[model samples]
Target chain A: MKRTQFSLGFIVRRSMVHRRVRSLAALLALTVSAAVATTLLTLYVSLNRQLHQQFRAFGANIVLTAPDGSTLPSETLATVRAIAGSESRIVPFAYAVAQTADGAPIVVAGTDFNAARAMDSWWQVSRWPNAAAATPGSPVAAMVGTRAQGFLHGDDFPLTYNGHTLALHTEATLRTGAAEDSRIFIPLAAFTAWTGQSASTLEIQAPGSAAQVEDLLHRLRAALPGVQVHAVRQLVESEGRIVDRTRSLMLSSLVLIALTVGICVLATLTASVLERRRDFAIMKALGSTQHQVALLFLLEAALLALAGAAAGYLLGSLCAFGIGAWNFHATIPPLWQAAPAVLLLNLFVALLAAGLPMRILRTMEPATLLRGE
Target chain B: MATILQSAVGSEALIHLHGLTREYASRAGAVRALDQVTLTIERGEWVAVMGPSGSGKSTLVNILGCLDQPTHGSVRIAGTDVHQLSRQELDRFRAETIGFIFQQFHLIPYLTALENILLAQYFHSMTDEDEARRALASVGLGDRATHLPSQLSGGEQQRVCIARALINQPPILLADEPTGNLDAANQEIVQEHLRTLHRAGHTIVMVTHDPEMASLADRTVELHHGRIAAERRADLTAQK
Candidate 1:
C-alpha cells in the first residue's frame, strides 16, 4: 500500500486545528501577556518625552539674578541671549520703589510686556497691559498686581520715585499667587525713564536636560563674569526626580507583568500538553523518537507565540495611543523599536512553559501509557 | 498431539531470545514478569501465546517489539540485538521492523482513519496517500477513510489499527489480543483480515486467551507461570 507524504508542519497544523478549544486557550493566554508587555514598554518609552514636555509648562529651570543692591548691565540680556541660543526665552526686569499719591511705598517692575507674557504664560491675570498703548514717552500703562491694585483708587494714579513724578494708568490686575502678586508691571523703557535704572534680573525659560541646563549655567557664568547664574534646584531637581521615579516604577511594573503572564502561559500550556499525553504515547509507540516529539511540541508553541505577539503589538499600540492622547493631548505612534523585545519575551515565555511538558513527554513509558495506565 | 517445527526454520533465526527477564520494583520487593525465559519465532509463522492474567504474555511481546528492555537478557530480531541498540536506534528498528496491534485499538482519536495509516508511514519514512488508501481498502475500510476513530464502531476502529500496523510493511506483526474488545461478528471480521495477512507471508505473533482463536494460528505456545508449558502445531490441536 502506498503512503502519503506528511510533513511535520501538516501534522502540527492538523493537530492544532483539530483541538480548537485547547489551541484557542493557549493562544488567548499568550496574547494577553504579549499585550501587557507591549503596552508597558511603549508607555515607558513615550512617557519620558511626554513628561519632559509637561515639565516645560512649569516655566524655566534656570534663573540669573543680580548681586545684592546692584543692577545687571543693560547689555546682560543680549549677552545671555547670544550664549543660550534661540531655544531660550530671556525676559529682563528692572525694579523701583515708588511712593503713590497717598505716600504708600509700592514695588514697580518694568520689562518687555510681550516677553514676560510669553515666558510666564501660566500666570493668571485679569488682563495684560496693552503693549501697543505703552510705547516709549507715552502715558505709562501699568498691569497692577492684586495687592498693589488695593492702593490705587482709580485707573489714573501718580507715582513719585526720588521726587521724579510719573503718571500711571492702570490697564489690568494680575493674580499670580506668588510674590509677583505685590508688584506693578510697566514697559522696561518706561521704568528706565522713571527710575534711571537698567535691567536688574533675568528670568530665563530654557528647554533641555539637567546636564544641558548645567552646561548653559557654566557658559552663562563664563560669558557674563561676576553675575549670579544658577539652576532653580526646586524646579530642576523635582523634574529629574519625578521622571526618574516614574521610569523606575514603569520598568518594575513591566517586569512584574511579564512574570505573571509567563506563569499563566505556563499553566495553560502545561494543561494542554498533559491532556495530549495519550496522543504523545501513541506517537511514541508508532516509533517516533523523543526528539521528534519534542520538536513537534516546540513548533506548536512557537506558532502560538508568534501569532500572539503580532496581535498583542497591535492591541498595545492602540492602548499607548489612547493613554498618550488622554494625558498628553498628543498621539503617540507605535514604537516599532519594541517589536523585537516583545517577540523575544513572548517566545521566551512559550519555550519556558514548554520545557516541563517536553521533559515529561520524553520520560514517559510508551508501553505503560499505551496500556491505558 | 504436537508437531515441533524447526526454531531456525530458514537460514537464520528470525527472532532469537536468550535468558530474557523483566523485573519491576514494587513496595514489596521485586516482581519478576518474565524470568530467564528464552523463545524463538521463525519467519512466516503465526504463533499464538495463550496465558492467564499476570503470566508475562504482554511483557514478552513488549520486549519482542522493542517497546521495552529486559533487565537481564539479549533479544535479537533479524540479527540485530534489541537490547544493545541505543534509544534512537531502537525507535528506528521498531518503525522499520515491527508492527504492533493492541486490543484497545490505540488509534489517535482525533485523526481520520486514513490519517492514522499515514501516521505510521510518517514515522517509518514518508507517507503515500495512495498506499494508505489501499491499506484502508484492504481492511474493508476504504469507504470509511475519513471517519475518526470515535465515529467508528469498536470493530471498525480495530480495523483501522490493523491498517496502521501494516502500513510500514514490517516483517513482524505483534497483536496483543487484537480481537479482545470485539463481539463475535467483529472478531470474525478482524480474524479474516489477520488470515489474509498470514497468507501473504507475514510473521504474526498474537496473544489471545480464546482457544478458538488460538486454533486458527499455525502454532500455539501456552504459558503457565512465566514458562512455556506447551508448544504444538495448531493443526494437531484441531485434529485432536
Candidate 2:
C-alpha cells in the first residue's frame, strides 16, 4: 500500500461526528468554560478602565481647596492645568450662604458652568445656561438644582449675600442624584461680582494610571504653595476597592468554572474513551501502536477545544455586552487579545482531561480488553 | 498421536512455536492458559483450532496472532523472533504479518464498509480507497462500501471484516470462531469466503467447534485445558 496523502484530520473529524453524544458533551464543557472565562476576563480587564471612568462621572477624585478661611489664587486653575494637561477637567467652585426674599438661606455654588458640564457628566440637566444668550446687564443666568427649585421659583428670583443682591433667572434645572442636587449654580463671574469672593475649590478629573495620578498630585502640591492639594480619597478608595473586589470575584468565578468544566470534560472524555475500548483494541490488534491510538484521541480533543474556544469567545462577547448593558448601561467591547489565550487554555484543558483516558488506553492489552466481547 | 501437515513441514513453514506458555495472575494466584503448547504452520495452509470453553483455544490463537505474548518459549513468524523485537517493532511486525477475523466480526460500527477496510490500511501503511473497495468487492460486498456495519447483515458485515483483514495483505490470517455469531446461511457465506481465501494461497488459522467447519481446514487440532489433545488431517479423514 502506497502512503498517499493521508489525513489524521479526517479521522478526528469523522470520529467526533460518529460519537456525536460524547463529542457534544465534551464540546459543551469546553464551550461553557471558555465562554465564562471570556466574559469574566473581558469584564475584569474592561472594568478597571470602566470603573475609573464611572468614578470620574460620580465626581472628581482630586480636589484643590484653599486652606483656612482664605481663597485659591486666581492662577491656581491655570497652574493645575499646566500640570494635569488638557485632558484633565478643572472646574473651580466657590460657595456662599445667601438669603432668599422670605429670609431662608440657601447654598449657592459659583462654578464655570461650561467646565462643570464637562466634569459632572452624570448631571441630568433640563438645559444649560448659555452666557452669550444672556444680554448685557440683564438678570444673571442660574442653573438651579431640582431640590433647590422649590425654594426659588417663578423663572427669576432675588437672593441677597453680604448686603449685595443678585437677581437670577432659571436657565436650567440640574439633577445629579447627589449633593449637587441641594445647591444652586450660577456663573463664577456673577457670583464673584455679587459676593466679593474668589474661587475657593477646584475639582480635578485627572485621567491616568494610579502612578500618573500620584505624579500629577505631587506636581500640583509643588506648584501651589499655601494651597491645600488633596485627593478625594473617598472616591479614589471606593473605586479601588470596587475594582479589586470585582477582579477577585471574577478570578474565583473563572477558577471555579474552569475546575468544574475540567472535571466534567474529564468525565465525559473518560466515558467516551471507555466506550471505545473495543475500537482501540481493534486498532491495536490491527497493528496500531499505542502512540498512534493516543494521538488520534488527543487530536479529537484538541479539535473540540479549538472549536469550542472560538464558539465560546463569540458567545461570551455577546454575554459580556448584555451584562455590561444590564449592570453598567454600557457596551463592553470584545477583547480580541484574549482570543489566543482562550484558545490555548481550552486546548490545555481538553488535552489534560484526555490524559487519564490515554493512560487507560496505554495500559490496555488488546486481547484482554476484547476478551469480554 | 496429534497429526501435523506433512506437506507443510519444510522451509515453507511460516509459523514456529516451541513450548509456548501463557499465564494469567489473579487473586486466586496465577492460572496457566497455554501450557507447553508447540505448534507450526507452513505458508498457505489452513489450520483449525477446536476446543470447549476455557480450553485455551482462544489463548493459543491470540498468541499466534501476536495479540498476546508467551510467558515462556517463543513464536517465530517469517524467520523473525516476534518476542525478541521491541514493542514498537513487534507492532510493525504484526501489521506486516497477521490479519485477524473475530466471531463478532469486530467491525468499527461508526465507519462505513469502505472506511473499515481503509482503517486497516491506514494503520499498516497507506489507505487506498480503490484498493479497499476492490478488497470489499472480492468478498462480494463491493456495492455496500458506503453502508455502515449496523446497516449490513451479519454475513455482509463478516465479509467486510474479511476484506478489512486482507486489505493490508498480511501473510497470516487469524480467525477466532469466525461463524460463531452468524446464522446458518450467514455462516455458509462466511465459510465460503474463507474457502475462497484458502484457495488463494493465504495462510489461515481458524478456531471452530463445528466438525464440518473444521473439516474445511487442512488439519484440525483439538485442545483440552491448556494442552493439545488430538489432531486430524482433513485428507486422512477423507480417506477414512
Candidate 3:
C-alpha cells in the first residue's frame, strides 16, 4: 500500500508535541545511559590491552634464585629440561664479590643471553650485543633492564677484574623485573678465571608449562637440602589475585551504573509509548499494517538512539581523553581504536531499550484507540 | 392510458445485514444496542435514522459503518461478510466501502485541511494530492485548504470533515449527527451539502434527533429501544 510520508510525519510530530515533557525525559535517560556505558566499556578494553602488553615484556617463564652461595647442579638442570612439559631454554650460573682499582665493589655473574631472549617476548631491544668471548681477556657486554638501568644511572659502569677496572658496555635495556637489570653479565670462562667458581646458580625457564618448572624446582630443592630456591610463581599468583579483585570491582561498578541508566531509559520510553498510543492506533486504523506500525516505533527508537549515540560518543571520547591526560600524562587511545567499540556498545543499548516499546507496539488495538475507549 | 411503464425501477442495495444483534456491557447490566435488527440499505438512498435519545440510532449507525461488531448476526457490505474478515481486512473494508461524518467534525486539530484530507488516504493509496484537492473543492473549502481546524469556521471545519470522508469515494456515507453541533446557519449549510451529495447519487445514512433533519431523507427509519419502530417514505411525507 502507498503511504503518505507527510501524514506519518504529522503523526509523529503531533505525538511528540502532545507530551513534550515525557518525550524529553525519555531522550535524556537514553542519552545518559549511552554515555556512561560507552565510557566504562572503552576504559575496560584499553586497560586490559595495556596490562597484557606489560606482562609480555617480562622474559622469564620461571626464575629460581638459590641462596647461601651454592651453585645449582647439572643433574637438576638436566632433569628440568627432560621434564615432559618443559621448554629447552634453561641456564645456570654462579656469582662472586669482586673489587675495582678504586676499591668500589660489584657482583660479577654468568649468564646465557640467547636463551633469555626467548622467555621475555615483550623485550624492546635497542641492540643485540655480539656473542660473549670464550677466554679470560674477552670483554663482556651487558644489556641493562629498565629497573637496573635506572639503578645504574643510564650509563656504562666499571667493575673490578683481577685488580683492574673494566668498563662494561650498556648496549640495550631489557624492561623485565626490577632486579634482573642491575647485575653484571660475563661469560662463564671469564667468571671462572676471575673468581675461580666451578658451577653457577640456576636461572630456569620451562616456558612450555608452569608445572614442569615447579617440578624441576621441587626435585632440586629436595636433593640439596641446604640450598634456597625462589621462583616468581608465588609473586605472579599474588599479583593475579590482586588484579582479579580490582577487575571485579571495576566490572561491578560499571554494571551498577548501566543498570541504573537502563531503568531510567526504560521508564522514559514506556511513558512515551503510552502517551502516543492514540497516534499509533489512528495510524493503524487509517490503514498502516502491523509491519508499518512496528517500523514506526523502530524509526522513533532509531532517531532517539542516533541522537543519543552522537552525543554520547563525543562525551565519552572527551571524558576518556581528559582522564588519560590528567591522570596518566599520556594521550588516550586514538579515535580509530575507541570509536568503533563505543558505537557498537551504544547501538546495543539502544536496541535493548527499544525492544521494550516495540513489545508494547504489538499489543496496541487500533479500533479501541480510535474510539478513545 | 398505460403510463405505468414510466415508473422507477427499484434501487440496488449497497449494505445488507441479517439478524444483527449488538450488545454492550455497562455497570447497570448488559444492554442490547441492536437487537436482531435485519436491515437492507439501497445504493444512492439517503436514509435518516430518527428517534428520541437512547433509541439505538447511533448503535445502528455504528454497526452499518463497521465500527462495531454484532454479537449474534452478520453484516455484509458489497457481498463481503465483515464479521468473518480479519481485523486488518475489516478495517480495509470499512475504508473502502464507507466514509463517516461525525457531529464533532473530529478533525485532527494539528493538521491542515489538506493534510486532514490526505490522512484518509494514508493507509489505503499512495499520495493522491489531486484527489484530496478536488474533494475539498467539491465541499467549497478549496480556498481554505491550508487552514487548520481552529482557523476554519464551524461550517468550514465541517466541510473539511466531509471532504475527508468523501476522499476515498466509498459507495456509502455514514453521518452521525452531522449538524448536531452546528449553529442554525452552519446547520443549513451542512444540510445543503448533504443534499448535494445525495443528489450526486451517493448513498447516505444519517443519525439525528431532529425530525426536520429526518424529513430531508428519501426514507426515514424510526428506532426505539434497539428496534425499528417505524419506517416512512419521502413521497408520503412530501404529499402531507
Candidate 4:
C-alpha cells in the first residue's frame, strides 16, 4: 500500500495537545528551574565585576615611602608620575611639626590637595579647597582636620616652623575616620619651603587586578631605586578575600539550586511518563520500535526544554535587573554571554530528568501493560 | 515437532503453531494458560476461536499478535518463525503481517477517528491522510472523521477500531471479541464489515462466544482448560 509518512513533529504535537494538562505541568516545572538557574548564573557574572568596583572606593592599594630616615627626593614625584602614567592618582605628602600661636605644637602634612581628594573620595569634608586658588607656589588654603580644629584658635591661623612661618587660609574641615582626622593639610610646595624638606611619602590609586597591581609595584620600585613600594594589605588583601568569598558563595548556591530544581523536574517527568505508559504500550503493540518510542519521548522533552529555556532567559534577565537594582543600586544589563551555557545546562537537566522515564519505557511489556497489569 | 506441525498443514497454510505453551506464576504456583496447543489456518480463511472465559482465548490472540511470547513453542506466520525473530524484527513482522481489533476499541481518546487510523499507519510505516480518510469511509465513518472516541457511540468507536486495524493493509487480522462491547445492532454492523474483508481474501481469526457470529466463519475451534476440545467445519454444519 502507498503510505504517506507522518512527520514526527505532527505526532508529538497531537500527543501534547491531547494531554495538555500533563504537558503543561512538565513544562512549568522545567521553566521555573531554567529561570532560577539562568538568573543566578547571569547575576554571578554581572555582579562579580560590580563588587570589585565597589571595593575600589575603599582607597589606594599601593603606598610608597622613602627608605631609612632619608626623605623621597623632590624629583621622586616626577619619576612616579612617569611610571604610574595618566591613569593613576599620585599624592605626595611632606610632614613637619609646626607650633600654633598658643605655643602648642601640631603635626602638619603637605600634599597635592586635588590628588588627595581624588584618591580618598570617601573622606567627608565640610568643604573642599579650590585647587585653582592655590596656583603654583601660593598657600591660599589649608584644611584643618576635625580634631586639629580644636587646637587652632580660629579657622585662619599662622603656623611657625624652623623660624619660617606661613599664613594659611582654612578652606575646609576634613573629617576622615583615620589618622588624617588629627593632622593639618597644606600645599606641598609651601610646606617644603617652610620645613626645607621634600615629599616624604606617596599614596597611589592604581586600578587593576592583583597581578597588575603587583606589576605596578615592581615597576615603581625599579624606577625609583631607593623608594620602598608596598601594597596596603588592608585594602588589597581584604578586597581580594571579599571578592573571592562572594564568587564562591554565588557559585555554590548556583550549583545547589540547579541540583534541587533538576530533581523536581525529574520527579515531575517521571510521573508524567508513568501516566502515559498505556499509550506507550499501545504504540509498542502497534509495532513501534523501542528507539522510535524513545525518540518520541526525548523529542517531547527537548521541545519543552527549548521553550522553557527561552522564556527563562527573559524572566531571569528581568530578575537579575531587579536584584541588581535592589541591592547594588545599579542597573545590571543581562549577561548575554551566559545564554549558551544556560541552554546547555537546561538541555542537560531536561535529558537527565527524562532518563528514568525512558528506562521505564524500555522495560515495559506491551502485553502486561495492555492487560492493565 | 515443528516439521510435523508444518507438514500437517497444507503448503497454502498461512499460520502454523506447534506445541505452544504459555505459563504464568501464580500464588498457587505455575498455571498454564495455553498447554501445548497446536493449530493451523490456511490463507484467506476466517477461523472463529470459542471457549469459556479462562480457556485461553485471549492468550491465543495475544500470542498470535506477537504481543506475548510462549514459554515453549514455535509460531510460524507465512512460513516465518516469529519466535526466532529479535524484538525489533518482531515489531516489524507484526507491523507488516498483522492487524488487531480489540474488544474495548482502544482508540486513543484524544484523537479523532481519522487520526486513529493514521496512528496505525504511522506505526506500520507512514500515514497517508487520504488513505486514512478512505479507510474511515470504508467503515462508514467518513462523515464523523473529526469526532473523538469519547464523542462516538460504541458502534462508531468499534468501527473506527476496525478501520484502524485495516489501515496498514496487513495480510492477517485478529479480532478479540470485536463486538463484545457493542449492542446487537452494532454487532451486526461490525460483523458485516468483517465479512467484506474476509471475502476480499484477508485471513481472519476472530474470538467470540456468540454461536451466530461463529456460524459466519469457515471453521470454529473450541478450547477447554487451555486445550483444543473440538474443531468443526462450518460448511459441513451448513451441509448437514
Top-lDDT candidate index: 1
Tens digit of lDDT per residue, candidate 1, span B1-240?
001112223337688889988888899999888888878888888999988998889988888987777889899887777666778877887887888898989898768999999988888788889989999998899999999898999999999999999988888899999999999999999999999999998999999988888888998887767777778796574321
Index of the highest-TM-score prediction: 2
Q: Residue B235 CA error for candidate 2 (Å)?
A: 4.8
In model 3, how many backbone clashes occur? 5
Chain A TM-score of each model, in the order shown? 0.80, 0.85, 0.53, 0.80
Docking class of 4: acceptable
Better of 1 and 3 by lDDT: 1
Candidate 3 local lDDT, residue A15: 49
* Cα displacement (Å) at residue A125, model 4: 3.7
Residue runs of model 1 more than 4 Å from their true location after superposition: A1-5, A68-105, A108-122, A125-144, A153-174, A185-199, A205-212, A323-332, B1-11, B223-232, B236-240
Per-residue lDDT of candidate 2, residues B1-240 (tens digit):
001222223455699899989999989999998899988887899999998988999998898888888899988787677787777887777787789999888888878898888889988887888898789989888899889899999888888889889988877899999988888998898889889889988999999988889989998888888888877788755321
Number of clashing residue pairs, candidate 2: 0
**Whole-structure CA lDDT of model 3:** 0.67
Local accuracy of candidate 3 as per-residue lDDT tens digits, B38-102: 77878799999888887888777777776666778877666666777776666667666678787
* Cα-based lDDT for every prediction: 0.85, 0.84, 0.67, 0.84
Q: Model 2 residue B172 lDDT?
A: 87
Clashes of each: 9, 0, 5, 0
Query: Over the stretch A212-246, how does candidate 2's per-residue lDDT look in tens digits?
Result: 67788888989997888888777766676777887
Q: Model 4, range A1-373, lDDT digits (tens) per residue?
A: 4554466677788888988998998888888887898789888987666775676667788889998756898788888888888877788888888998888889999888888888788889888887566665444588899999989887678898987887887889998889988899987877787788888899887766566778889999898888889999777777777777888999999999988998998888777777777778778777788888888878888888888888888888899989888887778898788777777777887777676777866775677677876
Could you give candidate 1's per-residue lDDT for residues A95-162 as a string of tens digits?
98999999999999998888888778788877877767656655688889998888888989999999
Which parts of model 4 have CA positions greater than 4 angstroms off?
A1-5, A43-51, A68-104, A108-122, A126-143, A153-172, A186-199, A205-216, A328-333, B1-11, B25-31, B209-212, B223-225, B232-240
Candidate 4 clash pair list = none
